[model samples]
Target: MLSMAWLASALIGAFSLAVHAEQSHPAGKVHLGASERRADVTGLRPIITWPGSRPAQLGQAPSASTTAAPAPPNFNLNELMRSILFPNANVIFNVQIVDPGEKPKGPPPDIAANFSISGWGDNLYPRWDVVSYGAVGLEESAYLLMKPDRLCQNGKPVPVKREDWIKYVAELSATAKAVYTASLARDRDAVAGLADRLNESCATCHQAYRTG
Candidate 1:
């Protein structure tokens, strides 16, 4: 490699000498100086160049562009509500049926069948069918929680004070909304805590009604 490099350098020097000698005008023009014999320098530049911008680094992120990027995951809000409402449906049921590392009682069904979730016959999950009225029920529960004592006012008898209802519902909604939003924002471990609020609401309702 050393000899080859030396050989290459010698060839280049010889070529440059030949070119310069050819450019000399037969030793004539005794009045012409070396600078005068040179080519025009006004528009000339170094042959090699580089970019003005720096490249992205190893393991470093590129600058974000404002182009059309792939969107965030499309989590269906309706499906999420439905899944929460009926925790025993399809995948949810299968997951709940098994303890950690424990096998389920049966083999897995086809995806087509699994997707077609059906109603449980009994109190296995009462809130399932009634989830269609979720918005109404949630609003009613919010009102009751806000004004619990108002339930028996001027009419039949019930429990709870009016003003405390507002406080209770606000507490539940705020926490649930925050955790659920974080889950939607891609926090993988948020669903369980948010789901706990739902169960807590149900337990409170059951205690209040004596049969929720």
Candidate 2:
């Protein structure tokens, strides 16, 4: 009878140890059945876990508190110049070279008919609105140029951190604002007069950073 009692106690202790082992198992070390092991091996098992070991709801959006904020956009310096600064600067520069009030000699082009493309002579030139937009674009370009993560054409990061680059961008912004004010007043002479200062601002920056 004593031997039988001893055997019963030993079996109870082993059973308790087994249960404790399962409960105390570290995360991701849970024992799996053959089918579970097969599913894991085949990558058919879901791996995501929720707080307090709760199962995730199907098709449910994650809580905003848990979601990461989106990253800021990055831009290329060359593309920014070609698309924004160069085109807008041309609008200001054209006011100096071409008479904005001059009428087109020929009939309106196909671009005017179907709006297939944007042109300078009839669509952009002589229009105070377009020139104003151009100046606004130039002012905005100053901020864009200073944005972090912008890359140059050579795959190197833009030197926005440099003091000279900051000064150049500030000059561009101030020049753009002056052009915008002149454009608003419809003062062709004022816009024309500021063209030299605008050119000088751009040329100085290019000579320092862009040219070989």
Error of 2 at 81 (Å): 0.8
- Candidate 1 global Cα RMSD: 31.1
Model 1 lDDT tens row, 106-187: 8655644443223212212222222212322343334333332232222433433534444546655564445434433433
Candidate 1 lDDT? 0.40
Predicted structure 2: lDDT: 0.77
* Model 1 CA deviation exceeding 4 Å by range: 1-161, 209-212
Stretches of candidate 2 above 4 Å error? 1-72, 105-116, 119-126
C-alpha lDDT of all candidate models, in order? 0.40, 0.77
Q: List the residue pairs that clash in candidate 1.
A: 145-165, 145-166, 146-165, 146-166, 147-162, 148-160, 149-160, 149-161, 149-162
Q: What is the TM-score of each candidate against the true structure?
A: 0.29, 0.60
What lDDT tens digits, residue by residue, belong to model 2 across residues 40-65?
66734455676787776444588989
Model 1 error, position 90 (Å) = 12
How many clashes in each candidate? 9, 0
